[model samples]
Target: MCKAVFFKKLKYRRDVLGDVIVNKHKCLYCGTCVAVCPMDAIELIDKWVEINEDCNDCSVCAKICPVGALGGVK
Candidate 1:
């Protein structure tokens, strides 16, 4: 039998800024960010995707974004 490797729960800093930043004007109503986010923080609303409470600020979504819609503030 194979034993599963248990991992500790991920604890992220609340004040940390995510690397993804959405440009409202440049956005094309694509769901790329929503699909790429591991934490499921982004959601599509009225054809536009928006970040929700589930955001862990990991920046995975930003890195995968093809159009550079999501990026860090700094």
Candidate 2:
């Protein structure tokens, strides 16, 4: 699906780490975050990514996102 359609279906959420956030519009749904999360906190479900409470805010996924989709609230 296109980015616009993906954005419409997905919504942001508050996480354990107030810092880490994902811009679904920029996300490619490539599972890069899911693979790099050391705590296994990131998941790619269908078209959206979910960061669970297991996340430690290591920023590993944000650093690895090819599209620069993962980031912080700031």
TM-score of each: 0.63, 0.73
Report the C-alpha lDDT of model 1 over 8-65, residue by residue, as the tens digit. Answer: 1112222234434577776776787788778888888996777766776777777777
Clashing pairs in 2: none
Candidate 1: where is the Cα deviation over 4 Å?
1-19
On residues 5-73, what C-alpha lDDT tens digit does candidate 2 reach at each position?
775445333442265788999999999889988999888888998887687788999999999999883
- Strongest candidate by lDDT: 2
Indicate the residue-level lDDT of 53 in model 1: 62
Segments in model 2 whose C-alpha atoms lie over 4 Å from true places: 1-17
What value of lDDT does candidate 2 attain over all alpha carbons?
Answer: 0.81
Name the lDDT value of residue 27 in candidate 1: 77
C-alpha lDDT score of every prediction, in listed order: 0.66, 0.81
